[model samples]
Target chain A: MSRRARAGVESRIDAPAGDGAPGGSGPGWPPWACRLAGVAIVVHLSALLAGVMGVAPASPLERAAMEWFGPYHAFFDLGYSYRFYIEPPPTPVAVATLHFDDGRPDETVRLPAREIRGPRMRHQRELALAHSLFVDARQAKEQTGDISQSRLARSYADRICQIRPGCEMVVWRVVQHLIPDRDQVRDALDSPGAGRFDLFDDSLFATPEWIGDFPCHGR
Target chain B: MPRPLIEIRRYLAELSVSTRAGWNRFFFAPADPTALGLIRAAVGLLAFWSLLVMGLDLDAYLGSGGWESAELAWSSLRPFAWSFWFLVGDAWLRPAWIGCLVVLLFFTLGIFSRTTSVLSWMIVVSTVRRAPAALFGFDQIVSMLLLYLAATGASGQAFALDRYWRRWREAKRTIRAIPARYRKDGLGRAVEPDTPGLPAATVSANLALRLIQIHLVMIYAIAGLAKLQGVSWWNGEAVWRMMATGEFVMFDFTPLARWPMALSALTHGSLALELVYPALIWPRLTRPIMLTGVACLHVGIAVVNPGLSEFALVMIAANLAFVPGLYVRRLAIAHEQPAVRVLFDGACPRCRGWMALLTAADPCHVLAAVDLTAVDVRTVHPALTEAGCLKAMHAVTASGRVTAGFDALRAILLRLPLFWPVALLGYFPGVAWAGRIGYNRYAASRPRDVPCTDSVCGIHSRTSPPAARDRSRSHAPNNATAIQEDS
Candidate 1:
């Protein structure tokens, strides 16, 4: 065999230390360091597993594991639930309209713009903020029977007011733009811009539901 | 002792010893550092890009009065959650951001890498924690990779400027000490300098890769299991729903609106890929197929949703842990070392012979010989004149640095690993000056296939030598592009 092929084979082999591997390890670790590292690895892996399993629909054991390991996960920012596209994505998108006091025109901003063509992360970031507000609203409604009392919604509005210097108050609302089923798509096939079907149809969106209204700090 | 009790005790003891050994082999086996270095460079670049984009609107997302106020963010933090942004006053925010960017730049370049990697990770964590409302999977994966890089401590050992600088310094030091050592020993033989080779394998490198691989498995398994709880995923409508969603959709999938079977197939294929990935990726025979499936899946996701491109790229990069370090090392070399193109006179037989030798020496194909006659010389560089190239050979580096005659030869030699010693010797105090003079004389005497009536020939010789020009060999040069085009 050629030298290159031989080196490749040597690299692949799980030989003992100092066996002339391509990237050879000189000597094995001391027993004390090995034992300490082994313990650390075990703990870290266990914490990671617990954090992942602790999302909704978890078992009792998983929940208990998370309770014990939650602090470590939070500190290191290793607490990923990995619930990506687990369910049908939510149809309703939240948006806020800003009202100005200093003769600036009233502006409306969608969390994720309808047609985000550039720097799409800006849209994703905005979408995350809006989703947080929606979650807060839902939780508040469930707990106190009033979605307007959501603290996150108020904080969001207040922050917006600060961003727009002359803004007096901000209004938050949720608009449902549900995805069309196959039948709906077929029905709208002959409509204008049929290739996009009802993607741009104004009637696709339901009436916006008011979440909250909050006044600016100074004003 | 009772016979049964003694037998049970021996069985337990054997199992304990075997398990401990297995754990040590799995986690502490020495592995190549090139893989970690590759991961570090990629993750560092991504981190830099992430932070740069975030900096575009720093005041809005991270400012004290912007999205999440200081009080609001502080109140929502988990007990141990911390951020430098919390303590920075309004006046210091930009300065702090500039400092983070500088550290991230150094980390990406692998300069002061050990310290920069740690600092870069801390910066990412602080920014992400500071503005929790504006993060996605991209931020999380970058942070995870950075954490591993910092832990490895050998992430800058390969495909790094640090490695090159260290090697150069060591070579210089050895060169300086050679005379002193030779005089002390009074030896007849020359001393051989200690040439740096591939980075040594370390337990830390193995530990980092194993951790990343295990973490990836966990992520995929959990994601796949979580999908089982959704009605759309069960009914195979998940793919259609994602494509139909206006916010995430990139193209008009209305054409596929009537084709539910195709959509269902895609949906089921994705779900199956994710569910089987964690289990199949561990086996030697199945690892390649699993990784390919992941690449295809993530690429499709990115195409369908451009916003998730960063997230998809990070996921693909994380999967590099399963790839062997040797293959990654080859890729690192190919990517890190840019090709040096040597512009030579295709009409000169001596130059073609020289080109053939250079090509033979370059097993890695780092040198590309561009025939001046095959294409417009001006296209390569507007300043390049055919007559000047014919007078003295020229080489252009990847960064557009041009050198001529002996310097060009030195540049080419530096790229060919086999001729590194000769290249280094040429760099000595008076060797290059003498070499340049020798090269000029050689160029003046060399024969060209073109006639002496040509304007370029008049500069070298006032009259032609007593021989007819070989027109047939003039256009037919044996360089990289000639054989393919002519034959």
Candidate 2:
């Protein structure tokens, strides 16, 4: 026979039976196909069950309904609502107490107090947002004593203007040249009148001693 | 007399019966006992190698994302579908693994042989699909063959585990009950031999084979024609330029660049050889020469460009299909001839002078001069005339046939080891025609000092009328001069 004709016959003979059959003849379908189909069904069903369980409700009436028919049902409803607010303390106090060793040169600068407002006050507002606030080296030491803690807190309200264009000592760093006497600074901070001012604690700032100390606490 | 004849008749009857039985066992048996064994061995080896290459951690390769990773694994199922089932069962693994496994099983077990074939085909298809960049020509060819095999029920008969099970079932049925059609005395009957015709399964396998064969021929013909379509191929510089590229150069040809002109000519010649290759297979006269030329080209490619070795091997293998069995026998016959022999027109001064130079150059002393003028022209070659010899060079063999001009040159080169290089020149584009024209010119311009003495020259003189001979003689010298100038 011609090769093409023979090939045609061979192709027909080789073709798998049930290729066109729907639901295929049972005997011809291998057992594995059925097994795979079963596995797929199980996986899909379990995923569906998990999805239903995740969206179920948790109130008394809803819980009761869920308990009775939770397996069959996909969702449950519950009802309630709540509200409230918190207020800031009045006359917030902020002490400025200077702690320096004996015979150390005191570097302090004093200026008339000023009010800061409007969009320009954002810098001070951002500074206040941080737990530890800093001030220029001159002003920190000058205002260290005899400053009411509550009035010191008001200084923050317009303190941003002190750093603005019209303000004196706009940019500064506290540079205390102190002798090495840790006990003296501790005694000054513990004194009864120390609460009146904001403290210029050089030990709290990053310094050689602070680095040696490793961890420091501020009050 | 009755006793001797009777014994002889009995002996002859027994011999005939035994011979018939032997034929039945060897050629017409219902089952190929070794077929299953071969299938199993092939499948097992394929599987073992695949698994070993995979290192039993098929996940990594399958996850790497391409068909090559799972090719060995999938090929194991090329005979049946058992591997495909195993793959489907492990669906949570990477799809490549699953796909490969599915293909393997389908190929192994021959279950829903066609469907599994298709499924395995799809898996292989997906592999090629997912990473076409990694696909090699061999991989594509294998995939195509696999799909064709799957569609054609390659494992339909004795070459499968399915067939074994079928045989086992049939054996069981035979043992359990004696069918009324075959039972004679309420006793179990021997099983009947299968009818003599093409088995459905065999038919399927043959179909796949036929498709492969057809595809192979088309690839060759198309590839050859495509090469011919290019000018570089016609000019013979295609090979040189192709090899000059960095990607193809595994070995440096830098020193050879000074002779780029020669290299370019060789390239153009090679391309032309390839272009006309398909045509050469058609004519019996050219088949051997063309096939040899193709083989040499492939061998050259394999040596110079190892990266193309696979292509060369496949093309060489495919070329074998064009070679008829008779040609192979002819080659075997040709090999018995002597290494070198000189053929010349003894009557022609120019031809004899060239032959003398060729003979003197034979350091190995292998040359044997054969004069066409001295031989019995009719007895030597019934197909050729004496006039034919006068027109061109002729080489006669023991079984004589006039090999003229280019063909004579080819035959001489075929016998000589050193001059084989010149035979390769015949494969060059347009060289054969040029050689023919050159030879005719040389033959026509024979010097007057060489006189014709016999009927051989008489035939040439008679064949051409006086006026035509005069005109040819006048123009022949100019043609010879032109040929020499062109060369």
Candidate 3:
């Protein structure tokens, strides 16, 4: 390890190697773009995770961020799954009975369950999401205050209007729960003016007026 | 700057260089074409099928007066920055939708590949924004796959017309280049580019594959983490409930519903798979087994759930990244003559440059190399000589013939199966004579740094065990002592 040998090595490198291609790390100073992309992707992943966690009592900033980026959550949350009545056997869940201006008063009207369960291509996916929003809000309402459920119900009304075309106004949004209890379900269906054998709407839990188009959709 | 601050600055600079090197190794390295090409064809067709399924209810879902009207969709998605429906009116919507359908067909067929790929992705984004309710995990997965595919231009490298078109042109050009002697024999005209498994590796393809791999891991991790929070997942009753559900119920599973133990086992098993998938899919040894397990799980979902076939297929397509192209190539070309090993002085700057150039040029990768200057050279080849190795390039053939200097390099080039026409051109009467003189003169022109010490050798610090050294130093062209079959 003499000075002479080290100098020789340096001199050899200094001499033109005649290699045509550029030195290693081709493309000078492009790491900025990569760093930017890297940061953006990380932020996106974090926002999606936050959405899936559905953080309650979130800070004002967190809520605002979620509201803005929440729609993008669908792509990231593909792994987030929610299947209906998966355990303890299938149970009947209540649906919002759609009563239109054309329908008679005091007559039973319900969400189209048949269309929701129809053949593959013919099956309208809109009913599924509408029903999901309805059930989710109602379930949340059981633990939280009435405010959360009311907001969700309003959103559902708008969504349903968008799905059911020419449905200018809704007569009522009151719906009764369908319990799994055989005796209770039978009583509700067999009652004088019952809606369906499995599920029927009651006037006990009447949500507020949902007469016009959603604010976003503009009547 | 103060002394301490200057030292800290130097340390930070070194760290930056190291980090950049690591990033390049992980993300910017070239990827083999086999897996990239396979993924493109399989995933592209699956995406096309998904588009078709969405098309069946296109008007009902995305039309102006349909269930999910354009106006309503736009309003609902106003928070988002962009939507294709915002650009086109009802009159233009049908044509746009039809254009997407046509573009997707071209994407699957790999026509105007890069252009069609971008168009296909645009269509996917439009569909997602317009009919958000109609989408499932399947749609999301196809879009994600297409996103990665669009980033890579070589997606159509295999099972594609693009490959054949390029091959035909290359063949025609190569035949024209051959000297009249070989041309008259018709050997040059009969030749074709053997690009099947030997896809030229590309940085873009490699980066896209790495992204897909990381994304897949994240998805599984999140899925498993999410399931762990659910109450039904704890008792395995959730599995039964999915089968017994209303709209999702494709088959009667009342019998499984009766067996609490079986259902619980399945539910827990599902959770376990999702959690462990990310961990097991990294190592080369376990990657295959992990992907097979994934395939089975997806297939089970597809079979039990009638409408989820597309989802299952696309997921399996994503797993294609884990399949090793090199392993597949070796398996496909088994029993061929083992590649000869070349030994060179990696410490020499010129030699290092030669290694880099030769590494890229050898498409079929016929020659293997080792650094003669490495300390472990003695361990790898007990009989390898220091002086002879430093003197010139040396390649030991599989049949154990020692070819020296320029011929050592030529031996490697000559071994390429597909580009033998080009090789023959180099080996021709006049070209061979000129090439030898040029290579010998280049070798002789180097300064004789005879008192070569440990400090002079660049690879002096790099001491590796035989197996590890062989794998890493296989890129280093070797010297006179040892020649083993390329691993």
The residue-by-residue lDDT of candidate 1 on A1-219, one tens digit each, is: 986895455444333222233645546678899899889999999998998998778899999998888788777888889888888664668788888888788888777666655477776777777777777788889999998988877777877776678888788998877776766886678567655575757776778889988788653
In model 3, the clashing pairs are A86-B241, A86-B242, A176-A202, B342-B478, B343-B477, B343-B478, B343-B479, B344-B477, B344-B478, B384-B481
Q: Candidate 2 on B1-487: residue-level lDDT in tens?
A: 7999999999999889765544322222122112222332234233323323332333322332221223333442222232222343224445546445655664655555555555655555544433222333433444544544555455444234454345434443442332222222211112211221112323233334334443443444545554554565555445554444332335654344445477666676565575576455544457568778888887777666554454455455444434432232233234444343334554344554555334422322344565544443465457766567666766766555457777787777655433556878887889888988886665666542223444445433323346754654444333222322433
Q: Model 2: DockQ against the native? A: 0.01
Candidate with the greatest TM-score versus the true structure: 1
Docking class of 1: acceptable
Point out the higher-scoring one by DockQ: 2 or 3: 3
Residue pairs in steric clash, candidate 1?
none
Q: Which stretches of candidate 1 lie over 4 Å from their true place?
A: A1-21, A102-105, A114-118, A190-193, A217-219, B1-10, B174-195, B332-487
Query: Cα RMSD for candidate 3?
Result: 18.9
Between candidates 1 and 2, the one scoring higher on lDDT is 1
lDDT of each: 0.74, 0.40, 0.56
lDDT of 3 by residue, B169-287 (tens): 55445433322313211221123333332455555666667767877877787678766667778856566655544444456554443466776787788778888997877755566
For candidate 3, write residues A30-82 as lDDT tens digits.
Answer: 67656765665566556654554444445777667666666565443222332
lDDT of model number 2: 0.40
